[model samples]
Target: MTSTPPSPDAISYFGIEVPFMQHIGLRPLLLDSDRCHTLLAMRPDIVNSRGDIHGGTLMSAFDFTLSGAARAHDPERLGVITVDMTTHFYEPARTDLTVIGRCTRRGRSLAFCEGEIVDTAGTVVAVARAVFKLVVRQPA
Candidate 1:
């Protein structure tokens, strides 16, 4: 299905106000029923020794973006926790990165998601697949 960029309100709807997201300047650009997209600007603090974006940084974005997609499958906005994830690094990212995630399947209690990170040049730098467990947590 086609996915458009998320409106500002839609980004907030997905709850982008988190410490880690803020620290890395992660911006949720798109949010739809089965898809989500995010952008992370290149920063010196998040780069590795070789001056490329760190793997952990990309993984965090993947996890969050994937969960956002999975959350769309839940009308109640139930909490989703990553149960397991597998990521593959294809190249180093030297510029801003954009991540796209899609929920492949959603069950009553679990969801499967896939995501890819692309560099400023539109080259995919990494890919990830993850499983998340959907749960209803008591409000704080």
Candidate 2:
């Protein structure tokens, strides 16, 4: 996918409102509206017993970032709910991590996305493929 760099303020999505994402230090680095890039710092509170970033933490970040990708088609007017996700852990993320997600295909109802988590040195730690159902955003 091609993208221009995004400013910190450029990211504005429901994922940022997620309490768990916030608790885990998942920060949106970019979301040029079609692709989502996120950062998570490795900290004691967010690690597994082995002292590496936990799989659940990685999965949560992917879910939020991938959902952002699905919603990017029409963000303000669109919403998404996860239909399914398949994730694979490749290694223990021992340092800060970045996740990037992009929509591979989008149909009228379902959008498919793929994402990966990489370390500061660009080693991939995990990957996830997901499907999300598009919905209209209801007025608050």
Candidate 3:
């Protein structure tokens, strides 16, 4: 399944507004056959008390990005429920960041993906792996 990178105006899986993407400072960096990745320019407002990008924010981004990847593989109308997720925080992200999620394996009913969050300088900040239960809509 060959996929092309979506334009900036392309709609995201979360149904996020294009302006909101800019507001959140996330740009769709790359979209490939089995992956959709985004880069986020971290803002102080999204940082934690320790001055690091909050873990929850990273997790949210990870989930969103992976779901995008899954959808790319199967555009059939469906919702993804994250059955399980595990994240490892390697280092703190203080500035601009990049989050990449790639579908490692896809099944008829489930998809597995892994993602990483890195600082602008290319240091790993966090890593996450998730399994999503893909629910396909049936004809009414």
Candidate 4:
């Protein structure tokens, strides 16, 4: 069986159509060679005990965003898997968040990317750097 490549405009193009992303209201707005952007609507249930967006949530968003950026910038359209990620929380986020991700460098089998989470007011809430491994699929 063969699966068609997702349309560039489709959310599936960035692998953002998963159940968790849907449940968290993650919306991919733009994805191109230079960068990727996503929106996460604030949900009360997704907040921490202190009523702010949880660190885990931010990390998850960063991972997704960075992965998307790497894929977008790859000419081969190869599959990507996150190898490692380091996240830093600068401030607690209390509002909806916009995640911006960019590809820093790409090699034959790996890619490095960075992402930032910002609130509605444009304050940086968190930042992340991640490495993804690119995989090639052999034709059947």
Among all candidates shown, the one with the greatest lDDT: 2
Model-by-model lDDT, in order? Answer: 0.84, 0.86, 0.77, 0.82
Q: Between candidates 2 and 3, name the one with more favorable TM-score.
A: 2
Worst 10 residues of 3 by lDDT: 13-22
**Which of 1 and 4 is ahead in lDDT?**
1
TM-score of 1: 0.86
TM-score of 2: 0.87
Per-residue lDDT tens digits of candidate 1, residues 1-140? Answer: 56455545433536534557767778878887899898999999999999998999999999888888888755355778899999999999899999999999999999999999999888999999999998875544
Model 3 lDDT tens row, 9-28 = 66564443344455566777
Best TM-score among the predictions, by candidate number: 2
Q: List candidate 1 stretches off by more than 4 Å.
A: 1-13
Q: Write the per-residue lDDT of candidate 4 for residues 58-104, one digit (tens) a residue.
A: 88888888888887865344567899999999999999999999999
Query: Listing every candidate in turn, what is its Cα RMSD in Å to the true structure after a full C-alpha superposition?
Result: 7.2, 7.4, 6.6, 3.8
Native-referenced Cα lDDT, model 3: 0.77
Clashes of each: 1, 0, 0, 0
Give me the runs in candidate 4 sitting further than 4 Å from their true place. 1-16, 74-76, 137-140
